[model samples]
Target: MINHPLECWLNLRMDRPLNSGSVSPEELQAWQFGLLRKTISHAVKSSPFYSKQLQGVVPDEILSPADLNKLPVTTPEDLRKNPNSFLCVSQDEVARAITLSSSGSSGTPKRLFFTSGDLERTTEFFQYGMGPLVGEGETVLALLPDSRPGGVGNLFAESISRLGAKTVYPEDPSDIPTILNLLLNSRASCLLGPAIHIHALARLWKSKRLPKNQVRSALLCWDLLPPVAIETISNTFGCEIFSHWGMTETCLGGAVECFQGSGMHLREPDFYLEIADPETGLPVPDGTSGEILFTTLSRRAMPLIRYKTGDLGQIISGPCTCGLSMRRLGDVKGRLDTDILLPTSEYLSMAELNEIILQYVGVLDFKVNYQQQSLALNIALDIAPESKIPTDLSRALTSYPKLSRTVLENNLKINIIIDNNDGSISSGFGKRLITSS
Candidate 1:
């Protein structure tokens, strides 16, 4: 008997032969220009925020890339300052109410509304992004906690249901043993979850000793997949790993990779992708890093065009042999503002730096502070002391050149603190891995 549950997905997805994922870059640009124009007009005509901002301005006449910037970049600040005013459509039409965390750098929360169509389009994203990886009747174990009103977990469940896969949702991230047992007995063929949860599972598997096979493919979504987590997953679980990059505000499925293991293939048709100089709001050529911008096309409740995502990445101009025409974003460099300033006249991204340093096991939690030329490391470990970091680490730390000379010349000191988070972990809301005070 075949598991035919995923037939619903076929009906929900595009009927066209998406098998060949490429549209010429020139074609994509033209298509995006039209969508951009439409989306801008929709926002200005419906959303009070845009209408007020576009006062004395016409979105329809705003053609050409140069005129696009004249509209202005809408920030989280704009939305929080006024939520009801940002409504693009009336309340009766809205089918769902989705609340999202504030995109602000600090405290306070923001709630946004989504119509039924808004939720459906988000689910459709999975058909293109993960449909290639998951086929009819496959079982997918979602390590994500199931919830709605906007989150990766709920959207993931919706996507899996569309693809006709069984979703064994874990109640929480800390519930490792219960989740592992379900995966063992339930015959889940594929796995998808936050990388941290998977990494924590890898740690538990090693400590408790459990069966590793049972999984055919795994997807790392929601958060950055640390390099260490990738190797541990492939080596221990022996399953293929595909990196997922998206934001809850943008919906769950923005991009995904095929089994080919190539770079992430963005979902371009649903949203326009952009990398621009943050300060100038001008497009940067492919391969040069800049802030990411997204424009939602199908959304009617809260349409956002050229909305700043706060994330940083660049496009992959070269072709992807995976046959996906949707553009690719470079292995993301975290938030544009999440920078560490070293006293050595250089800025550092703790996320980028730890992507290199967290290769070893037991480096459970780490925080790097480079203030006033001082590079201090706060590490939480399950094993391996400072002595195990290799004498070269000190020298390698010095190799930063500018930061190194200052430290060696008695201008600054590097502090390494080994604090055990006591195995506590969190997703979305709290601080973990790399964080600022």
Candidate 2:
């Protein structure tokens, strides 16, 4: 738990009007229902897409969260098909436009628009979300893109500046020596970037044998931070590592981890989150893994009603030790589209594979390749030459009854190749694809 006085002081300073975590669930629901009605009315009247999507459904009819399912889901394909139809504001009124191509997409990319007020709300969320880790007089080194106006990096810098802190955004983050110099010279207290990039820098810092413990804290975004990666980074920098979950659709500001680090505290005041069956789109019981569906309650430019995020996770209820009443979300368990299919048609989630692989000693990184009648696991090990595959790992894999039976009944070939060269494993900004032909 965080220090009580400090948390209170930061909360007061941030002056967040919707710290719904501090209120009762009933109160939060009432607040959310009111916002939902208003958002629905606005979107239907302004956005051609929502106007057609919500045909015959009165905004007032959605009095409860469950009734929200009466509306159809807005999918990425829908956004890509005709993005202009989703816009509530005119093109001239748009403050920022972002084009993103989803993995495996070959057609037109999905476009998202945000007004100046929308961007300001995201910045405000960042300001409040980061208050616990960042404070006055500290320098935050942002390793995200900051050149474009109204981009995520620029908004992040603005938010830090609003909190009376200086920000350092590298023009080219690939240049390691330059970033090291900036970190050393500026005496930066907080480091924020994708997990892969931050891990790479930490390894580079260790390889150079630089002075120890320069950074005070680190916030990793964009990708999931494996336990080993978090441990290595924290050890290298001698700082606590935090994680945040969001997407471009949400303007890049969403749930964040408090000092407790149990789970990500949801930004319920701005968005209402629900866990639903990926196939049926019906709400699932709390703590049950399901697809994450969210509704934009405050967004003006492109308000989404029950948007299917494709990401997988569960909603955690109960009070947090940090004293925040907001609900939390479990660690994202990869995407639904990326699940690996077996010969027997059984699906293996990447999160399950990650949990098993990261526990082995001397394992640095790994990639999974699915080919004709075979599953190849290419692993990068930290061990020296002559070290063979651990017997314990073989036993652990076979111990999982489902996997063991599938491997035997289907006669599926499982090959494990251990490579000592860490460079063989590649990292990306978002979900890393493990499947290959």
| Candidate 2: tens digits of C-alpha lDDT, residues 24-113 | 577667778888899999999999999989989888888886797788888888899999999998889898888886655455788999
Per-residue lDDT value at 217 in model 2: 88
Candidate 1 lDDT, tens digit per residue, 55-169?
7666566555566666677777676677777788889977665556643465556557778788777777775466656777877877653363355357766777777776776
Clashing pairs in 2: 21-325, 21-326
Give the winner by TM-score: 2
Supply the global lDDT for candidate 1.
0.64
TM-score of each: 0.82, 0.82
Off by over 4 Å in 2: 1-21, 145-147, 173-182, 344-349, 352-368, 373-426
lDDT of 2: 0.73
Q: Which stretch of 10 consecutive residues in model 1 shows the poorest summed lDDT? A: 1-10
Q: Which regions of candidate 1 deviate over 4 angstroms?
A: 1-22, 62-67, 102-105, 145-152, 175-178, 209-212, 352-357, 367-377, 381-423, 426-437
Alpha carbon deviation, residue 394, candidate 2 (Å): 12
